[model samples]
Target: MKKTDVDVVVLGTGNAALCAAIAAKEQGASVCMLERAPKSKRGGNSYFTDGAIRCAYGRFQDLRAVLPDLDEEQIQQISMPDYGEEAFMADLLRLTDGQTDQKLANQLVSRSFDTIQWMMKQGVQFTVNENQYYEKDGKRQFWGGLPLKTKNKGVGLVQALFQRAEALGIDIKYDAKTTALKQEDQLKKLIVEIAGEPVEITANAVIFACGGFEANANMRKTHLGNEWEKAVVRGTAFNTGEGLTLALKAGAVRYGQWDGCHAHTTDYHAPKTGDFNKPGDIYKKSSYPLGLIVNVKGERFVDEGADFRNYTYAKYGKETLKQPEQKAFQLFDAQVSPNLRKEYHLPEATCYKADSVEELAEKMDVCPESLANTIRAYNQAVQPGPYNPAIKDGKCTKGVCPPKSNWALTFEKAPFYAFPVTCGITFTFGGIHVSPESEILGDDKRPIAGLFAAGEMVGGLFYHNYPGGSGLMAGAVFGRLAGEQAATFCNRTKPLSSKS
Candidate 1:
């Protein structure tokens, strides 16, 4: 096998891996990044995202630090209330049912914006997320806790990071799949395959940012329980738990919820894995809050208007998965169809429209009588209140079973719309344990020397639920920490002699 040596090796080429490489290089360490995919498909799950980042900003000054290009007109156009660290931490703990690891949550919340600033210093660009808020009388009113995204979304994020890495002289090897790892005295050797040829790479420190096991079918069945065989993968198909398995084999302690993951309602026709050709979050059906979601039986199984779509979308996917055949449908009337996100109008969407409820049900292959009864009861129960899509307008159902707590508009308009949906597993929550500095922890509760982890594979940041846009934020925060700590360790350790 061809053998080479480096100071630090970062596995995976996603946002976290790229951030780790950039941070390590910034800290004066010679870094090499290995991507399982070819050059054309380098970035992992980060490439499939919408590139929104949930950050805690006290005011416009905080946003101005990272987004220095924001003009006065842009700043005055939007109303972004203060999303402070305390509020961020509360949301994390609340969404996870207080199951979030306090240490990790604190770190994630405190360092959220600083990491973005760090990325900005490395030539990353940002823009205000205009879609995050609704316009009222030509005034932008923000609702969700996030209002920032990479310019041009995830494609732009990966391209910018890759370009920055290249400018910094970092060695990024595409088509290099690190399959196995072995210890030879003080050196860690990674067994990688490039063009069907096995090679060995020895490094002083290693950082695993390869993501979670969401793409692995058997692992999904084992960890996330049954009926996951049909769950659509929302990111790169190359992520099959290789790095996670390697870490486990190396005696790293498995941490967090083994059966928990981040899932959301997606188009039933979406591919088994995310399609890079599409390149955006078009497959996601996030407008359920503006309407109602029903199972194949034409029954409302979940509280569609429980909260803002951003906060509740993650957990609803599990509910969708539990439905018969792992399928559900989101129904919207003409009254609320105008509020649907842009993705709803995409050509690839599987949407059915009819002038009446029964006709819509017949077209959707649902029992017409059951759907009519459900909608009739739902409309009657809706409380009379002002309808506002931007906030919790309190236009709720008064006497309905599985109540719609907010945005409960009556389905009185014709040309009702319905979209078939299924569960799309974005990332798994189970992962290896890590220290405050992002060092991978062994079973003995001690830091594994020369080992680090970040991204979705670093557990305890989430449990049964997650907030939207926080995935990318967590990756950057921990990726930066892992890179900094790994570089410092590489600087102190001596090169391992060839004792194997």
Candidate 2:
């Protein structure tokens, strides 16, 4: 490959990268996207996800859909901003231990929605109302709606962004991976090693969209700690956090490390060898309070469905160690599989099943007698106001969430099932420090000239807890900011103050 130049050189080709490239091009700045992976493999694991972002506007809408009974108090419980920027800043403080620059977080949060509308104009789709308005809190609200309307929502939206990015004449290169960020005279450049040669491109702005390091297990063990490595399999190999590495090498500020985690899940469908996840892998469905989680000892442990967060393994303040198997079988009934709850995206696909408790135990690899007693005892909770202390005291109690129907499953019928499952991490919370203007920052909170950040790559800008579809919302948000801001910067370039 030959050398090239553009106003912005974007690494990675996922939602954030595509969003940034589109943003820069729309703002009239030349932008080029380089993907180390081939086009067919180019659909990074992000495509498999439902890009949840927690923008103030989006949360209000999603809450209407998922939690119809929600109110101000519930909103306070779920959103990051409830307590103040201090609570919202908690993750950043823990990640950098109060060493972070707050200016960047301020910038990303402020510009989020403007970013969303910009993408909407670019033809990226989203969900909309059935008629003229959506029902919310017993009232009607009307927003333009998401560009994509399928049940598989964000997937289509991302596809639309990809299409628009190509249509806009943005340059996208496959198999052009950047190895590092090289700085000269205090300026940043991408170092690409292609076909046994090093190609350097100095740019007005370098946007780090390369994803989190979930796939890179060794690296995960190093920075994120060994517990993460043992907890979940990587969802996207493309998201190796290479951009994060480059940003770190170039002295970019880091924030929200503690905020990021291997999104704890009932399954990422790791294969038997523990090698990279294969394409055919399917997620086993697990429902809250409906199933009892058992450890190897045939004893119930932590909550299987709650936000296990890393706290599940605090070891009373010691370094959190990996839990064995990281596997917990979800025991749901004939009804759970047929109609999984409303909030989940995919259909409920389950694992082993049997008519009798003895047979179900055989499939789950637990003692049939003990397993039978566990289910029988749990079923007894249905008749009363409170659950049996023994059953509630089990590790399974940890994962329980309200609206969770533990009593709904009586384990009473024939053909019960056990879905052997593992963990799935969606995104890491830590990312390049950026401003509300989407400007990438240096070690000291100053803008690194000619560089910007956006999407998941920019951290600590979020409100406290995740809002549904907020990740996608934020990606659109920051991508627009980066593009618009970089355009303004590029536009401001003037004829050298001619000192003739």
TM-score of each: 0.97, 0.72
Over all chains combined, what TM-score does candidate 1 have? 0.97
Error of 1 at 434 (Å): 0.1
- Candidate 2: regions farther than 4 A off: 51-55, 58-116, 128-154, 183-188, 195-197, 230-234, 258-260, 266-286, 304-322, 341-350, 382-410, 461-468, 494-500
Task: Report the number of backbone clashes for model 1.
Answer: 0
Off by over 4 Å in 1: 495-500
Expressed as tens digits, the lDDT of each residue in 1-500 for candidate 1 is: 89888889999999999999999988888888998889888799999998889988768667877777778887778776788898898889889999999999888999998888888887779988766888776778888788889988899899999999999999988888788888777579999997789989999889999989999999999888878876999889988899998998887888999899999999999998988898878799998998989998999998988899879988999999999989999999888888788899989999899998889999989999999999989989998888878888888998788999999988889889999999999999999899978999998889888999999889888988988899999999999999999988887786332224
- In the range 94-211, model 2's lDDT, one tens digit per residue, is 4344544466544434444455555557665444322222334444433222212222344655677788988988888787779877766533567787545778766666777777
Best by lDDT: 1
Alpha-carbon RMSD, candidate 2: 8.0
